[model samples]
Target: MSKPRSLSLAAYRVLSWGVRNGTDKPYIPRPEGELIWIHIASQDRQRVVEGFCQRLRQSRPNLSVLLTAPPQADLIRWDASSHPLVNLPSEQTGAAREFLDHWRPDLGLWVGGGLMPNVITRAEERGLPLILIEAEIDIHVARGARWLPDITRYTFDCFQTILATSPETVRHIRRLGVPASKVDTAPPLHVSPNPSPWPEDELIEMTHALSSRPVWLATWVQDKEFISVLSAHRQAMRMLPRLALILHVADMSETEPLHRRLLSMDLRCVNWDDGGTIEDTTQVILTSDPENLGLWYRLSPVAFMSSSLERGSGGRDPLTATALGSAVIHGPFVHRHQQLYDQLNRAGAARLVRTATELGDAVVELLAPDEAARMALAGWEIVSEGAPQTDHLIEIVQDSLDQRGQDHAST
Candidate 1:
């Protein structure tokens, strides 16, 4: 390394250390409600943390959650009403101490990797009950060794319970001196189901109006995949003339053009934004409002998750459809959610289709009442499997807080 650059880096670190330990303390009063501190390293895990917080709050209404993440995380995507978001402190003891002193969290839940050894060890020393969820042990251990020699063992030992997402991670943690009993393998955390925003009365009325008609939804369809969706619909329509489709375009601007194209094909359609009602002859329901997806997912017996037909889309999450009781069909390009899709496929909850013809065939097969019902049941099971892990973590947090309260009283 260049001498000048090395000197500059050292000076910057010294200045940061001085500021952290400075006498001028930042004024941050503790909240009246019980606080739980959650540290996440990246925004990719935002959905998991958000779901955990929501479930946690439902069980303990008075509990306040403080989510700490690096500045690069997508903070804006999270709902501020659910929890207060804060930037993570530098990995220095002085900074960590200052943050813990101000927040005074009753418990700590560290999610994902990038463990800050100094902060974690300090919190453990301060009697904080710490739990690590979905720990990436190998990555954390390597990173820790790079900067803080031999700190990995001490930090991994601090967690009261460590939930590793894979057997490999469990092996790594155990090798780092964490007791085998303290660590266990678990599936990755799943996002909590968001309630359907559509009104119940409307849903019931729509259900009656459609009256046993075979229905399918093409969710979040990009313009490039319109041909595939429409072709699949047309092919399926040849066999079941009464089949209805809910075409939800990803872009609102494409809604008008899509409506025109459907008209050009002489297919009867309804525009959701224009308050058009579904009639017996309506073949398609055109919409661009993403919020209304819950309604379609609930109504449709089968759904083809779009954005995966073309390359670079990485596909949208199919779990939402599965959670809402829809049998899923998608294209092969789902690298973004490959693990999820693979699990669903193995569980018989989802099907992969490479071409529009295959998509049509899959839809037709799943349209059968027995087949659709079977897949829907499997999908529901996959979605519900994560509840046990979430509940267990919540119970641990509640127990820790109860113990802390008793200790305070005795003291």
Candidate 2:
């Protein structure tokens, strides 16, 4: 790599490390054979690629995965049943290249965009098979790349297989010289299926502590949505006086203001920031611990995916709520995850509310045992229907790998 590129990479690593304690996620070097390397640019979208790695590992246990992304996705949960996950050193393409050299991944999966051009070149030079899963060439990027046909072709030519989500992606890939035969239509990888295993003791404790109250959760709640949700909770409380509200913020920093706002309503509130219990009279519990959101969702039958009550906050994922059997409710602005929500809504698994009053009404109605159970059944049904998507993708990957191995032996 050139000096400038090397310096840029160094800066990237520094910024990533500074953002969070560098040691929160300790790195483990690559292991053995037939590894899959995934490079992701979007943090939110990284879950899809992770899902692919996880499912692939499930069917084929011996394979390994090396996941490299900068600050956006810095940590790897090292505890999954099979395979290992490692964070790539940011900007240090040399380190990334060296790691790949040692692991010698047979297949690479690049998710999302903005991957440096040289990274693709290095993988090609090493003869490592590359696939871009659910990839698209953004209009701004396509326009810029169009100015240089040679470079654009080189970028597009690097992929051995390309799975695209839309026609525009297919057109862009064709422009770069990939034969139509090599690019296939595939659904975006399913949401990762690993549900948080709520501890039996904790669940029992939560059940005892929070039982008999109608609990509702608003996850990843933002500023505008947070206020609306709090207001809705107050309004909903008129009908269901024992309503328990749980708020988990996308950023931990929002906890203080949210806490104060709840207190101003004279509603009993508690914060999990310092850790505690949900007392009998506690009206709201504010938490910044995201992992706790999973536990809360599992405990509550009704969940409102936040960042959706108002426009501009693109909305949050409802897959976890669905997978955990929580009846989901969201605002009308669910564009970021339209497909998942649409499927759930169509299945009668989730409801869309356009205003605070509507959301409050839905919460009150969903609290009914019969209604909540009905919604839960529908949500699970929709999730159950999509379970095979993960298996199908894994089967495709395995078959392709087996074919590649056979061809290599014949040649």
Q: Which candidate number maximizes TM-score? A: 1
Q: What tens-digit string does per-residue lDDT give for candidate 1 at 1-411?
A: 001223322333343352253543354556787899998876677666777787888888899888888624545344223567777665554676778888988889988888876567668878888999889863332222355434566677888889988898899889877789999987777765545467999899989989989999998899999998889999999889899999999889999988998899998998988899989899999999877888889999999999899997788878779988999999999876676788899999999999999998898999999999999999999888778878888898899888878887898
Worst 10 residues of 2 by lDDT: 1-10
On lDDT, the leading prediction is 1
Residue pairs with backbone overlap in model 1: none
The TM-score between candidate 1 and the true structure equals 0.76
| Model 1 lDDT, full chain set | 0.80
Give candidate 1 misplaced runs (Cα > 4 Å). 1-35, 40-50, 61-90, 93-106, 112-114, 125-127, 134-150, 163-200, 401-411
Give the alpha carbon lDDT tens digit for every residue of 10-63 in model 2: 333333232223554545665756667777766556556665676677688888
Task: Give the poorly placed runs of model 2, Cα more than 4 Å off.
Answer: 1-34, 37-50, 57-104, 108-192, 395-411
Report RMSD for candidate 2: 9.4
Give the Cα lDDT of each candidate.
Answer: 0.80, 0.72
